[model samples]
Target: MSKIGFYIANLVKRVQNYSRFKNVFLQRLPQRFHGAARLLFYHTFTADEKKLATEIESFRSRIPALTTDKEIYSYTSPHSNTFQTDEAGNALPGEYVGSAAEAHMKTGSSTFNGILLRRIVAGAGVKKILELGTNTGFSGSYFLSVPGTELVTIEGSDALCAIAKQNMDRFSDKHRIMNMLFDEAITQLLAEAETFDCVFIDGQHEQKATLHYTQRVLPMLKPGALIVHDDIYWSEDMHQGWQHMVQDPQFSETVDLFYKGICVVGNGSGTKAHYDIGEYLPRPEIFRKNW
Candidate 1:
C-alpha cells in the first residue's frame, strides 16, 4: 500500500480502537452482512472471532488458578532432560525448556510456555537457557523463577531490553540479558561459543526473519536442544514461518501445536509429530497472569 494509504488505515484503526460502538473497515464487501457491527473485520481477523470478545466477559466471571513453577515443567519428556524433581513439581537445575516473547502479549509466556518450560527444565535438568526477543521481561521473569537457573535473553530494542533486564534482576541476580537486537546479536552470541540446553526464538514476526534466526542459532544448540517459536497463528507470516520450520528437511523431530511450534535437534528418525496443545496460560503464582 502507498504511504498515505497506510497512514490513513492506521488512523482508522486507532479511531476504531478507541471508538464507543466500534467501526471496523471491510476491505472487500461481504456477500452477506448480518448487521453493521457484524461485518467481517480486516484481513487480520475473521467474523468467527467476535465470539472471543464475549468469551472474555465470561472468563472474568471465574477466578483464575495458579500454575506453579514445578507444574510448568511436568509436561516435558520424562526421559529427555533428567532431573530429581519432587512430586510437588520442582525444576532441578540443568533440566528446563525456554520460550519466546512478543510485544503485545504481556505475561503470555507464563500462561503459554511456563508449565512446559519448567517441565522440560526439570526433565532435562538444563542449567542454562537462551531466549531471543525479550519484551517486557515477563517470560524472562518466568524462566528466572525456576530453581537454580541461568538465562540470557536478547532483544534489538535497547529500551525494551533494559526493561527486561530490570525484571530479570527482580527475580534473580544470575541472568545475563543483552540489549542488541537478534539480527546483530546472533553473531556475537555465537562468537561466545555458548551452547544452551534450550534455545528460544520469539522476536520478529516475518517468516524469513524467523528462519534466519533459527539458522543463526543452529550452531549454538547443544545435543537434544529444543527451540521454541511463539504465535504460530498470530499472523500469516508466523504460520508460514512455522510451517517452513517443520516441513523443511533441515530439521526433524518437531512438534507443531498450532499456538507454539517446537524444533528439536538430534535423536529419533526423520518422523514428524504434530500435537494440539491448544493455547494455554502460565502458572499465576510464579508469573503475572493476563486477564
Candidate 2:
C-alpha cells in the first residue's frame, strides 16, 4: 500500500510540474520569456547542494519514530484534533494527539524543510541561531548536526519541550530548549541583548505577529544575518506577512522558495529573487524588485 501511495504521489507531482511548465513558461512565448530564464536560474540545484540533501536524508532516516511515553490509548478519547487542510487545499497527514505524553503523537516538520533549514544554517555560516518553534526536536536534530553552532529554540508547550529535550540530548549543552511562549522568550532574549546570526521564525503564523517578529527580530540580528520565515503561503495572513517582509527596507534582499521565504540584512544591490518550489510559482515582485 505504501508503494502504491508513493507511485500515486509521484504521478501527481509530475502532472503538477508539467502543468506549471505550461502555464508559467509556455504562456508567454510572444512576450519576453521571463519564466524560462527564471526557471533556468533557480531550478538547478548545485552538486554540493545535492550532496547535502542526500546527507540530510541519511541523517533523517536514522532518527527514531515518535512514540508516547505513557500508557496506550489514553489519547484516543473524545477530544483529539487534527489539521487536515489549509485554505489553499494543501493537505497534511498524521493524527495529532493532544498535548500530553499519553496522546500518541506523530507530528513534526517535513524532511525536505529540515534539509532546507540545515542548508541555510550551513550556507549562511551562522554561528548563533534562534528558532521560534521546536516541534519535537525533529528540526532541532538537523540544527545540532552542524559543528560550532549554538541553537536556542522556544516552545510554548511543556510536554513538547520535554520531548524535544530528550531528542536533543546528543548535543548536550550546545542547544538550549526554552519552554515558554514566543513573546516571553523573545522578551528574555531582548533583555539579554542577544543577537543571532540566523533566525528561523516558525511561530505565530498570523499576519500581525509575523510582521511583529519580522520587525522585532531585526535589532537582534547581526549585520547580514539570514532571517527565514516558514509557511509563506499557509494562508492569506501568512502571504501578507511574507509580502511585508519582502517589501520591508530592513531586509534588502530576499529569496522566496514557496514553502519558506529567506531574507538578508545587508546593503545588497540586487532585488528580491523569487524561486518556485513544488507547485507554487514566483510572484511578479521578483521582476519588479529587480527592475
Number of the top-ranking candidate, with lDDT as the measure? 2
Model 1: per-residue Cα lDDT over 68-90, one tens digit each:
12222111112221334346332
Cα deviation at 16, candidate 1, in Å, is: 39
Determine which window of 10 residues in candidate 2 has minimal summed lDDT.
72-81
Model 1 Cα RMSD, 1 decimal: 17.9
**Evaluated with TM-score, which candidate comes out highest?**
2
List lDDT for all candidates, in order.
0.52, 0.61
Worst 10-residue lDDT window for candidate 1 reads 279-288
Q: How does candidate 1 fare on TM-score?
A: 0.55
RMSD of each: 17.9, 10.4
Model 2: residues >4 Å from true position, as ranges? 1-105, 267-291
Residue 47 displacement in candidate 1 (angstroms): 37
